[model samples]
Target: MPYITGERKQGLLLPSSIEDYINPSDPVRAYDAFVDQVDITELGIQTEPNRVGAPEFDPRAMLKLLVYGYSYGVRSSRKLERATHHNLSFIWLTGGLQPDHKTIARFRRDNQAALSNILKACAHVCLKLGLVEGNTLFVDGTKVHANASMKNTWTEKRCLESLKDIDSRIARILSECEQADASEQGNPSLVKMRECLGKQGKLKEKIQGVLKDLQAGQKNATNTTDPESVRLRSNGRLGVGYNCQSVVDDKHGLIVHSDVVQASCDSNQFSLQIEKAQQALGKPCATACADAGYASTEDLKKSLDEGMDVIVPSARQVKDPSSRVKKEHFAYDAKDDCYRCPQGHLLRYIGDHKQTKSRIYAVGDPEQCRQCPLFRRCTNSDQGRRVERLFLEDVRERIEQRYLQADAQAVYRRRKLRVEHPFGHLKQNLGIRSFLLRGLAGVKAEAALAATAFNLVRITTILGPEAFVQRLAA
Candidate 1:
């Protein structure tokens, strides 16, 4: 049997076309058509006519290259530069123009705002295609590794210790220099010592600046490599990264809103993400579902007040393991504004605890509880059995009641499917586990591009290349 053979170097009589190299159904073609139809001005791409220096490449082409490159998991500027030269699809997308790595990197770095606008534009396109159901959004956050290294991160105490060590070393070196200078003149060791001193001085100045900023309450932890990156606990490991939050629509699992935050916890991000999603969609979200991490009393109350139906489990429901008596065991007497304990003891409401923002309700007589046989099983505190209810506990209770209903639970169950699928695809399929850009702004830009690419792929999947091209034409 003869093995199939192919020509390594064959001369062609007819001229080869970059267009013919790519198929009509190729997603790159769809992306090219999409970019051509969209207004570059809305994407914040610079399109001014250049009369002076060398004529600049069209921003539209550069954006198309980036969107297409990122869609295929080519994130590095060097790799993208290489792709333009070697990859036929990229050649077709860039129209035979190969911008250097520096140009590509600068475009990404300087146009973070533009990249975010592009993400919004992609979401708007999804909305127009009926791919996104703006009425319902599933909100969640994932910890994506930053471009910084955890080894470069320092706590306040570590910085202080480092500064102290630096000061001591400088003092010791200066004393040694003074002693050596008295012993010998114009020594090579003295010159090396002076150089070392200068280096240490500059380092001291940098550390001191960081310390000053930290003392002034500007930052929590400092990372010398990427100052904007925070040291967060992610997936049972400590790392320097950003908390990327996304609001995904339920209809087609399209991302409607996304943001990169420095906070490790997502408790305070619920209202902010919901508001942003509403603004992006130009309408209020009928319902928002999230995990227990976003179940803060303040945020839940604020979301409820804004007429957003928020479905989130309590922190205990998701995290707590102890099988202790639950708050539901206590019966509330609305008429008397008191709680009845399991032993039929009336727990009267004390003064509101302003610091904790809760109404303190405790058994009226501690003596009776102390004498009771069940005291050992119930009262762990010396002050007797007490229950603290949030001032807006009713709002949370109402949500919990609604969540108990079959329909609300069904909607809540869809949260994981709607929100986690995109994250899994980005991390596992596209290799977006860590960001290639440093700082929050750059990370946000990378995330925006990633989301745009994901949305583009999704849109192309829903509408084939020809149909998508027709949509773009329309």
Candidate 2:
């Protein structure tokens, strides 16, 4: 019933190397080897041991710290800095060099592009190791809480209110200046007045800029703390956050690409992310799977036209409330370019719905529509039931059919498990539900490292620790 012998605080200790502490099977060993193999200096990270003012922490060591931290969910710079001082694996990774939090934070902030390039390099490594099969690739997105306070969130109405308040202040200031000028020519306090004007001008410009952004439909809600972060709903709760997208090969669920988008929706995210995956993997994906959120006519056109098999379920239309009749209950007539209601009424083509890029069909005879037994059930609208079919409706229909197939559903169902490998581990296991960095750029830097860390863990898991280390050396 005795614990392992403890060392005395003041006793002379035997000389020991930190490297002795890391096990051969430790994932950190593979991570160290991976960083050593990557040419980070060429990827835009400047490293020179001779720099003045402070000892430059080697870029390789810094990258290892970041990536290793992310692998276990230790993303805070301060925490990573502390890890250098006490964490055994970290001490071995850095060789006892402890860079302050500022240094750690600056490296990540300034080398985001380089860090992102490292993630691409990881994809290439996956391909090299045969982890990426170039077959079915699952693309998915999840929202992470941004490093912003809800108090800073501004709605369109809030922006307008701010603008109005600024304008009134400006008016009052200018009127006071005019009164002062009239009271005395060459006002003795003209310099102070000019300073006041300048300050007001800058204030007005900032408010106007926010107002302009709100008016331009940039985002529904913007946070002043991190202007690029948008208010989005994730896990059925509204919060200020960024959308993080990931592309994973179905074979090993290894991430091939990732990015932090400012937008809240995945509708327009597929094109850019998939293209990056192709560029990284050095080959086009044979097939791609995504959830219903990613199914947009514009994006589907691009993905399909690019020759990638896509299985994104189209957005479900609202079903008739009274009768519980779904839009699918209606039949489309290609020859007539109309829809036949389940109740046997002809809904003729009306016009193109520009917003949706779809053609509208409506029942011309409200009397006939009301006569149907499913009238109020089918549609409560007095104008009769209407349907909007996309000009590219055939593409959606094809995708819908493909998604319903036994084979396609089998592949599609794996999307959550496949893509969520990184996110679930990052969030639930690593306790990274909220980002520690603010602004889109900072969050992106964090994401690049976080993803690279994930790839490292996945790589080691697939190859085993010893082989992973040996492969990096190879």
Candidate 3:
């Protein structure tokens, strides 16, 4: 069989207009049209030329480049810079203008506020399309590696030990200088001693700075490279990374809001993220769905107090196997202020659990516990089974009751699919498993860009590029 022949590069003929090469339904058109429609000036992108040295590139054009780069999964400044030179879509998006890598990087780094506006603009389009009216929003986070090395981590223990080592070296250096001045027999020279001492002094300052950060209580450990980042464990592997959070609307899996946090704990982020997500969506989320990781007293109480039904199970409930006896098996009797075990044993309230700030309840007699059938599976203690009810246990219990309903379960089940898809797209399909920027601010901006791209693509898919842009114009 003979292979088919194709036109030579030099002999190839194509449309004169670049727009003719891009399909009408291509997602880049939506990205372009969206940026063009956005009031880049109000979004903080400069519309006028600078009075200084060089005429500035249109912020609108630069905004297009960043959003399109994120949508295309070319996040690095250098990669995006290269894309402008040859990538047909990028060339079409920027109208054949190729900015350098430095310019591309500076544009992204400087326009985080405008990027946020772009995200809000995407959410507005979704709202107009009725994509965010589901009343259920899923909030979750994933660990994305920072532009920092895991080996650059500093702990309190390591910090203290390093300080001690530096102190000793400094002392030795001082002694060497004294000896050199006195005899010149053992020590090399005064200048060498001074240089060694200066080096040790700088090392001591760096370690002490790390020590100060650790003591500030933001994180127990610190990375010298990215100070705001913490040690995060994702997919059973630990690394220096930030917790990237997204509040996804359930209707079409649209990201209503996005943020990046320095803390690894998800429980503390619900109220903060929900407030922002609601702001972006322009309406409150009636029901919030998250996994067991977000079941905290502060969060659950706040959600209930706000009249928003939050569906979240405790980690224990989600992780315990069917064969294992879970905390849920021990039912709480609010009327009696006691707990009923699997064997119908009542564990009465004993005393206040001061350390845990909870009420402790236990079987009065250990001897009665010895007669139980599920004792071995329930507890290994000779003191019988004990349960600690938090001060806000009622809040968690209320959410727990709501979570058992079939409707709530149906909504809750959608959390993984609705929320994880953005991350899956960003990390797997878009090739952004790790962030291209460093520090919390830079990563947050990067996440916003990714989310904006996702929402823009989703809108195009639902409405088609031409249709969405037409709606934008309409």
| Candidate achieving the largest lDDT | 1
- Tens digit per residue, CA lDDT, model 3, 177-197: 887888875564788779888
Clashes of 1: 0
**Per-residue C-alpha lDDT of model 2 across residues 1-474, encoded as one tens digit per residue:** 988887668677644877787889988899888888788776778877776786577788888888899888888889999999989889999988899999999988888778767788788777887778878888899898998888888787887787788778778878878888888767768657778878878877876787778889756777888888888888788888899999988998888888999777998778778888888888888898888888887887798998888888876731234456677899998998889998788989978888889899999898887778887777888888898888888888888888888998889779888997788898888888888877777787778778888888888877898998777677
Residue-wise C-alpha lDDT for candidate 1, range 201-220, written one tens digit per residue: 99889888888877887677
Clashing pairs in 3: none
RMSD of 3: 3.2
Residue pairs of candidate 2 with colliding backbone atoms: none
* Candidate 3 lDDT (Cα, 0 to 1): 0.84
Per-residue lDDT, model 1, residue 311, is 85
Error of 1 at 11 (Å): 2.6
Among all windows of 10 consecutive residues in model 3, the one with the lowest summed lDDT is 317-326
Model 1 gets an lDDT of: 0.85
Off by over 4 Å in 3: 1-23, 50-52, 168-197, 216-218, 322-326, 329-336, 340-346, 354-356, 365-375
Q: Tell me the deviation in Å of residue 29 in model 2.
A: 0.7
Q: What global local distance difference test value does model 2 have?
A: 0.83
Instruction: Go through the candidates in order and give the C-alpha RMSD of each one to the true structure.
Output: 2.3, 4.6, 3.2
Q: What TM-score does candidate 1 reach?
A: 0.93
lDDT of each: 0.85, 0.83, 0.84
